[model samples]
Every structure is written in structure tokens, then in C-alpha cells.
Target: MTRTYRIAAIPGDGIGAEVVGAGQKVLQALAKLDGGFTLDITGFDWGSERYRRTGAFMPGEGTDVLRSFDAILFGAVGAPDLPDHLSLWGLRLQICQTLDQYANVRPARMLPGITSPLRNVEAGDLDWVIVRENSEGEYSGQGGRSHRGLGCEVATEVSIFTRVGIERIMRFAFELARSRPRKRLTVVTKSNAQRHGMVLWDEIASEIASEFPDVVWDRMLVDAMTVRMTMDPGSLDVIVATNLHADILSDLAAALSGSIGLAPTANLNPERSAPSMFEPIHGSAFDITGKGTANPIATFWSAAMMLEHLGETAAAERLMRAIERVTADAENHSPDLGGSATTEEITSATIRAIGLNAT
Candidate 1:
């Protein structure tokens, strides 16, 4: 009675394909362990490249395929030639919003052998998660350009907020904070200025804080939050912010930790029947495509996050410990981590560290 989990594998454009290939290898290795479950992966060729070939990102009929999956393992999704709106909003954003994946969770932490650009910080000095409201706020596709043929043409994009969206994301953040070793939650908002939506965010965060009495809670304006992140990131645990704020803060957090190339994220629809989409925080690195130098740890850890989401916590922890072990070993690391090893070398080391054979 082995349970088989169907996963939608979207190896999007550029280095996305490269890193996702590595992630698939890692997942296969995990499946090979003495476990009661196996993975049935269905790869989706839907991205900028596909768009060029088919004039569509993801087919209308293909939505059913995505919905049928147990979970999704996503790669990056942008290209220089395509409009950012077409590459991101039309495809990746459509999937997430349509699926109601309201919580975007990104985890940034210093790896054992990676060094941060920040002064006086040792390896493994940072660990934090940014919980973003994914479905709404500034990301709500609500406005467009006006007077396109006139001299006074203006473009507008409306920012929206709902009580339901705010409340659930806040609750998710508090719950995540409780699960972490350091039980601290920070809410990032621009409530003083962006009164309509951010104020609601603040109100919801305050209400949620009362529910989680054991967790320490705090709030900061987005500007101040950025400054605090660089000066004292260790003091933070879980951070909840609107879509735009969270997007910016998470990138900063990734840099502070080590590299954006090492951060993993989960776009989660907690109430959905299907599992969430897990991916790395970095985008498709077209400049370095096929260079064999892209680091794959982020995608590997993202697979760990996916495992955790699937209730395979023991497997997830084991994978993470293996990642730590590999990173800690200076003799076997990718070039991005200051080692001379190639992508395949580092991935092989990670597999071996987890007691899996690199086949």
C-alpha cells in the first residue's frame, strides 16, 4: 500500500530548467529512501519559451492538470524579451491567484559554509521567514493605463485589501512564529500613509497577536523594517507584510542571510484540496543559463519545504540536516558558496550526505 503523490513540475525559463533539474534529482533521491510513499511527477512545459512557441503560457485546459496535482514544484518565470507582466502576471501570478494561494512564505537563512556580505556575521547567524499576502494588496490586478494616445497618458494600478485576506495571512504568520525556535513575529506596514489597506493590516495583526499570547509580537513601518533588518536581523523571527512590502523585505532578508540564490519559498493555499507550490526565491538567471555554475541548494531546500507541507516532516528535517552537512563541508560546495565545486559536484555531495546514491 504505497501512496503515490502526484507533483506538477514546472521548470520555467532559463536557469529555472537547470535548478529544477537538480531539484527533481533531490526529490528522486528522497523517494528512494526507505519510505512508504513515492512521487509521480508530471512536468509542465509552460513558461516564456512555451509562450513564444504556442502564443500561450499555460493552456486553459491545463489548469485541470495543475488542480489535480498533490503539490507543485515551481522554477523561476521571467525573460528579458517578454514583458514582465506577460511572463509573471499572465502565468505564475495567474496560477497563484486563481488557486487562492494567499500565503507566500519565504525562508532565508545563512548556510553553514556560506559567508554574508554583512560585517561581523559568522556562518549560520541568520534564520527567518517572511509571510506575504500573495493574492491581494498591490498585487490585485485592478487598474490599467488611461489616455494611451494622449500627451497626459497615465498608468495606474490599484492596491486592494480585504479583511478576510488580512486576517488569514496574519494568523498564518503567528502560527508559523509559534512553530519556530524563536517565537517572535513582526508586522511590516505603511499604515500611517497607506491608511486604507495597511491600517486594516495593522488591525488584523493586532487582533491576531492577542490570539497567540505566547508569541512575542511587534510592528514596524516598512522603511524602518528595512533598516532594522540590516542592523539587527537576529532579533526577528517571523515577518508578515503586504505583497509589495513582503516582496522587497524578503529579497533584503535573502541578501542578509547569504545569497538570494539560497532562499526557498512556498506559495500556499492552506484551505485548498491540493498541496502548495514550492520554489526558490531567485528568478530565472538567463545570463548564466547552461553555464553549469548555478547553485541548486535553494531548489533542494524548497523540495524539503514541499515535503514538510506534505506532512513528511521527518523527511524534510533529514533533507535539511543533509544540506547543512554538505554546506558545512568546505571541500564540497558550489562556486557561489566560495568553493570551486561545480553544480553537479555540490549536488552529488548533498545526496551522499543524506545517505542517498547519486544515480
Candidate 2:
């Protein structure tokens, strides 16, 4: 029996459409190569443009519509005219929170033919997977504006941390660390400054560390963690942090690895009760919207993660190797990686690489 997976692709805005189109091409190629399984993809037009036209990012029943799919392959979401918060919360956060996608996983590493900003860093030296608390903490949308449109206006965006949210993400990070060869995990937080929420994070992480004794764990203030990420890239393996903190650090990690264009993120529903969402960490590059130069490697890698989440590990591994192979060759590189190939060119090169490797 041939297995089929239904995927909801949301190419939110700007270059998102281009990069996601590239990812879908690679996925279709993979399906052809692996005849045992097939992918049924449906794209959703839900982002800034949709908001501007319909006053809604997605249809009113968007959640229900998405629930039927096995997984979601997402692209960057944002537009210059739309407020960042409005665009973000309207689509991405709404889906993640509503679906209980609590574990946000981001992998940052040096690609084959890319140069890291850090000198002497090579292929494996800066490889690290950051596990973020996705559903809650910092980005809970818990606060309000008391005196809006007034001279004395005050706005407060509260950070919320729950024991369950903290424990689950911590456990996920520890397990990930245990799976890696180093078996080391770095917990980043600002417990010293924000003593209340951050202290609880430390407490929960401390309690959970005992469960995975084999995984060596340590703590670092989020500030110091930045310096460590740059100075001692090899020392870190798996990292766990709050939603906002990890979100910031992962971008830094991406830039250090190569370019933000090459970083992929997985917003996972670990229990599999609902579909998880996969996307590149880079935002929709409005400046390069139709320039034919947006890098699609991140989206392709994101599809690879989506494949792994769907239990198509072999196909996922092949797709990743194909990406690495294409990236390894200067002729197939994109502008973001210091090469001049356009988006379609790189996409073709990647697909060709996958086909050649299969043979």
C-alpha cells in the first residue's frame, strides 16, 4: 500500500511565496524518487495581503481547516505596511497556540560551502539544536494597554510561564541532548533580573535534570550565553530557553552558522494530537520579494523536518543530503551564501542533485 501525507503550505508574504514554492518543488521530486509514499499539498493564502483585503489573516474556520492535514509547511510571515505584532499573532502564533504546538525546535549549523562569521569554525564545530518553549512564556499575549492614544499612555506585555510548559520543553531539550553524542545541554535564562518567571524556569529545569542524569546540563544567563555561542561554538550541543530568548538567540546562531536564510524551525505538537508547523527562521524578505534571489535552502530544510515529523525519515535524510550537496558546490549557491545563483536556479540544482544522488 502506498502511503500519502496531506500538507498545508502557508506561504505567508513577500519572498515567502517564492521560497515555499521552491520547497514544494523539492518535495515533489522526493515523492517521485520515493515511489512508496506521496505528498498531497494544499496551499493557504493567509497573511498580510489576505489581512489587508479581507480584514482576516485566515478564514474564520482556519483552525478546523488546518486540523485535517497531517502537517503544515510554513513560509516567512510579515509585510512592511502591517504591524509586526498584528501579522505575527494573526497567523503564526494563533495557529501554534490554538494547536498546542509547544515545542519549537531550531537547528543551526555550518553548511557545506558556507563560511561562518566566526573564524576557524567548520562543519561540526557550531552545530546546535535550540529547543524553545513555543506555546507560552513571554509571548503569551497576556498584557494590555491601559492608556492608549494619551500622553501618559502605558503598555505592558506580560510574560507568562506555566509549570507544564516549562517542564515539557525542558524534558524535550534534555532528551535531545541525550540523543546527541556530547550529551550536553545549556539552559539559558535571565533568572537574575526577572526573578519570578525565570526563577521558576531554573527550578523546573533543575528538577527535570535529575530524570536525565546521563545528559550533562548547565545554566547560563541569556546575555552570557550569546558570548559563549560565539567564542565556544563546539562546547554547546542542545540548548533550552524561553520563547522570546531562544527566538533571539537562534537568529544569532543562524547568522554565526551562515545566514538566517539557511535556518529552519519546527513548531512541534509533540503528542501528535494536532499537526505541527515547520518554517524557516528568516522573515519574509520584502526587499528581495521578486528579485529572484531569495535563498530557499531554509524552506527546503524545513520541509525535511516536516518529513521527519511525518515519519518519512529516509526521504527526509535524502532531501537533507541533497541540500548539503547543492550547498557544498559554489556553482549551485545563492546570493545569501555568497554565490550569485537565483532562487529557481538553486531549486533546480537541488532537485537535480537529489536525482543524481539517487542514481
Candidate 3:
């Protein structure tokens, strides 16, 4: 029996449409190789452009449809011309929060031929995962703006943390640690300043550590984590932090590996009843949307993550190995990876490496 998966394809704004198109092709190629599964990609044209057209980023019923899909393949979100809040909060954040995708998993690793901006660090020496609390903490959307005086406005945003949110994300970190070779987890917090919320987070993380005794765990302050990420990235394996801290750290982790263009992320609901969303960690590159220079590797690797989440582990491994092969090939490379290949060229090489050609 052939199993079919329904994926909500949100190409979003700017280069989001472009990279996601590349990812879709990669997914189709993987499915062709597997032969037992098929993708029913339902395109959802919702983003800044959609907002301009309908005064809404997505249809009211679109949320319902999203809940019904097996998973969501997302592209970048945001446009230079659009207000950041309008594109980020109104669309991307809205869907993530509403869908209860509480675990944001971003994996950062140096690709075979990609060079690091950090001096003396060789390619393929960096690999780490940032497990971010997606539901709350700074991103809880709990604050408002107040007019102080003429030409002045005071904006206050609160970082909300509950036992429910803390424990789950902590457990997620420990579980992830158990799977990786390093078996080390770093808990990032600012307990010295924001005593209440971070203190609770530490206590919960300690409690969870009891369950996974085999895994090594340590705690670090947010500022120190930033410095160590650049200075000593190879020592870290899995890092777990609250929403805002993880948001910042993940980007730093991506930078340690290479270009933001190479990072991939997964927003997992983890309940198995609802579909999780997978996307590249990088935002929409409005400047390079039509230039053909945008790197597609992030989206390709994100598609590999989607395949793993969909229970097609074999296919996922094949896709990843194929990516590694293509990247490791000195002749096939993208500009970001220090080669002159365009987006289409890199993608074509990856597809060929996977032994999938358009028929």
C-alpha cells in the first residue's frame, strides 16, 4: 500500500518562494527514490504579498487545513519593504504559536566544502544543535507599547515561562542529547538577572537531568554561551535555552558553521497528531531573490529533516548523504561555499548525486 503525506507548502515572501521551490523538487526526487510514499503538496500562498492582497496573511480556514496536514515545508518569511512585525508576528509567529509547535530544533554543522568565517577552523569540524523553547519566553507576545510623550513610545515585552513549557523543552534537550554521539547538553539561562523565570527553568532542567543520568549536562549564562560558541564550538553538542536566548544562540551557532544560508530548522509540535513545520533557519533574502545566487542547500537539508520527521529515515539518510557527496565534490559548489555554481547548478548536482533526475 502506498502511503501519501499531505504537506502545506508555504513559499512565503521574497526568496522564500524560490528556495522552497527548490526544496519541493528535492522532496519529489526523494519520493521517487523511495517509491512507497508520495507527497500531496498543497500550496498556501500566504505572506507579506498575500497580506497586501487580502488584508490577511492567511485565510481564516487555512489554519484548520494546516492542522490536517502531515507536515509543513516552510520557506523564509519577511520582505525588506514590509514591516518586520507584520511579516514575522502576523504570519510566521502566528502559525507557530497557534499550532503549538513548542520545540524549535536548529541543527548547525559545517558542510564538507564550506569554509568558516572564523579563522583557523577547518570545514566539517563544527556540528551542534540548538533546541529552543518555541512557545514562550520573550516571544510570548505579552507586552504592549505605551506613548510616553511627543515623539516617544515605551515598548515593554515580557518573557513568560511556565512549568509546562520549561519541563517539555528541557526533556526535549536531554532526549536529543541521548541520541547524539557527544551526549552533552548545555542549559543556557540568565538566572542572575531574571531570577524568577530562569530559576524555575534551572530547577526544571535539574529535575529532568535525573531521568537521563547517562547524558552529561551543564549550565551556562547567555553571554558566556555566545563567547564559547565562537571560541569553542567543537566542545558543544546540544544546547537548550528559552525562546529569546535560543533565538539568538541558534543564529550564532549558524554563523560558527558558515553562512546563515546553510542553516536548517525544524519546528516540532511533537504530539504526532499535528504536522510539524520544517524550514531553513535563514530569513528571506530579498536582495538576492531573482539573482540566482541564493544557496539552496539549506532548503535541501531542511527537506531531509522533513523526511526524517515523516518516518522516512532511510530516504532521509540517502538525501543527506547525497547532499554531503555533492558538497564534498570540489567541482560542484555554490558561491557561499566558495565556488561559482549558481542555485540551479548546485541543486542539479544534489539531485544528480541522489540519482534522481527529472523524467
User: Local distance difference test, per candidate?
Assistant: 0.86, 0.93, 0.86
The C-alpha stretches of model 3 lying farther than 4 A from their native spots are 122-125, 148-152, 356-359
lDDT of 2 by residue, 1-359 (tens): 88999999999999999999999999999999989899999999999989999999988899889999999999988999889989999999999999999999999999888999899887788999999999889999998887779999999999999898899999999998998999999999999999999999999999999999999999999999999999999899999999999999999999999999999999999999999999998899999899999999999999999999999999999999999998999987778887899999999999998898787
Q: Report the backbone clash tally of model 2.
A: 0
Which number leads on TM-score?
Answer: 2
Candidate 1 TM-score, C-alpha based: 0.96
Question: What's every prediction's RMSD, in angstroms?
Answer: 1.9, 0.8, 2.1
lDDT of 1 by residue, 1-359 (tens): 77788999999988888888888887888777837679999999999988998888888876667888989999999999998888897678888888888999998878887778888875445678899999999989999998999999999999999999899999999999999888889999999999888888898888888999999999999999998888887788889999999999999998888777789999999987655799997899888788888888899899999988888787788889888888787886666666677778878878787784222
- Among all candidates shown, the one with the greatest lDDT: 2
Estimate the TM-score of every prediction: 0.96, 0.99, 0.95
Query: Global CA lDDT of candidate 1, please?
Result: 0.86
159-222 per-residue lDDT for model 3 (tens digits): 8999999999999899999998889999999999989999999999999999999999999999
TM-score of candidate 3 relative to the true fold:
0.95
Candidate 2 lDDT (Cα, 0 to 1): 0.93
lDDT of 2 at 204: 97
Error of 2 at 304 (Å): 0.6
